[model samples]
Target: MLVSVKELHQQTNLGDVHKEKPKKFDHLILGPAAGEGLPDRLQCQGIKALNKIHFGMSRNNSRSIDPVAFVTVFTIYNSTVESRPVDLVTVGNISYNKVKRSLAILNVFINFIQVNMPQSKVIILTDPASELPLQKDMVTIKPIQGEYSRDKLMLQRIRSYIAFLETRLEKLSQKQEQFTHFIFTDSDIAVIDDLGQIFIDYPNFDLALTFRNNKEQPLNSGFIAVRGTAEGIQRGKAFLQEVLKVYSSKFMKASRMLGDQLALAWVVRSNPNFNVRRFSRREAFLDKIGGASVLFLPCSSYNWTPPEGAGQFHGMPLDVKVVHFKGSRKRLMLESWNFFSSSSDLSDTLCLILKSGRTKYDF
Candidate 1:
């Protein structure tokens, strides 16, 4: 059966929210991405719990709820300063647009969990008053600081933001006196099926992160799970700082491209007790799975797969769990609409057109 991206998402569902007491330490926390319409399933408290597990200082010491089973979706946005967008859209604004589409994908994930995982909850962590429209299961908290650049300097800023949030969450932990785990997933991810197997199988690694082989390399930073530790948090902070130092100045001058993802790749590569897994195209694209609990995911259709394969990776029109329309490079151009319309339509007409040799799918 020819599966479109949206259909794959709808199919993966958990029977119902397990009434049998929720499991402990299966919570998720995601940095909220910019968007208006978000799905009820974007709840990834499980992913956030994984992040807390990897980055939080101590489970007992943290002021978070325990035995939480859910996902936390984090929004990782880059700045326009780092990437000089040739496309006329404002980099920040484009980020919001990208988040909108990504939110659609997250809804697909929510649907998957309802049918497949059933026991997971998804949550959002971000500014409470931001423009994005939020639904139930989403908690909006005030950021410690005001608006900051979403650029190369963004890594440092985000780390600080994370640290600040952790500190606040720690206070809450103290008040409630509960130990908890957290997982942080960016908005650009789609959960395909029951990925609980990964977390259940691998318990040694402090964190699990996804890596790409190269540009055609699968999803880099598509998903990561970190243990809450001083060392782990320190590593995340230090690595992000160093990466920002390089990219904020000379690195940008050299590559003229800002990749916070590369920084994450570096840290994961250098860390001990950190399991870095790379997902193959088949696993990444065809499988349609990713989350904070996922230690590794390949760059594929679900997260930031190029519309026509313009970036390093050339993806086939396989069933995509989520399509992350990365705003960094406006590869999907809207100008001359009809000319490119053939590429996006899910009908056989486009496929037939490509078959006729008028245009190749090898964009």
Candidate 2:
């Protein structure tokens, strides 16, 4: 029952073919934030429309330096489910403390992009008017509004995941002209280093994503990058279509947790010619799975989590570029913001490791 790369991607040419010329985005870094901190479970209330507000960015507002075109996609879905905790908002109303802390964390990453990555323009994608105070300079807001069925998928907020997949990919396949590539990531993480170099170094890869669950059939859907070439966009669009086509089938339901993430994994792993890009360094291949052939970038560098304790990086195993902040919400939140907000960003982080003589810090 082994499936080779050929069989995996053999039928990629068998999907709906959209016109191959439309405006698409380049260097788009997007994510899902439909309902991150909202208290009420808005069950498909105001679906079918998106209320948008573009701040400081119009077609004619020219800036001295054109920044990197990075985007953050957020959603306030119509489902009554909260897949993750609300770290930035409180129950029933927005909390000032929560807002301050979360915005600080966001600023750390955004501030870094502005300072270190001067040319990389950052776009903030979120649900229409969540009232969260976001950084203004070198930032653009793209609000997504959509009505989705809540009863499907048990209570997971992955409807936005599927929606984003179909909407974005379809647009790209239509020759959506704008950006060159797209990176989909989670909101609760901070970037301490520049990841744009990865795409630049390996331009042939149609898709680049992180691995999880022991490199199984599904790549971590939250963190993915898609090249915007004709073939690249086509593969991406087809994969997304297949995901929606069989979303309610027996296989997805039986798994009990295969959202768009698993669907994407199936497509990429099945296709042999997708031209996936992995980390160039050897360290990334340390935990390769037999069948999941990807440029397995080292977790330590791409998505690093604490080994033990909450938010304490005393003994980090690798040179991390991003701290995913998966555990201990408050601690990670505070620490991540402080990490970049203060003068001690990446340089200081590395120096501490060298100074500690590779011994894990005891803080």
Which numbered prediction scores highest in lDDT against the true structure?
A: 2
lDDT of 2 by residue, 139-185 (tens): 76665454323334321334444455556566766767454555556
lDDT of 1 by residue, 225-309 (tens): 4444444333433433554554444344423233555554443444454433433233431111111222454343234343322
Identify the leading candidate in terms of TM-score. 2
Off by over 4 Å in 2: 1-68, 75-104, 129-132, 147-178, 212-218, 244-258, 268-296, 308-319, 350-363
Report the CA-based lDDT of candidate 1 relative to the real structure. Answer: 0.35
TM-score of each: 0.45, 0.54
Query: In candidate 2, how many Å is residue 90 off?
Result: 13
For candidate 2, the C-alpha RMSD (Å) to the true structure equals: 19.3
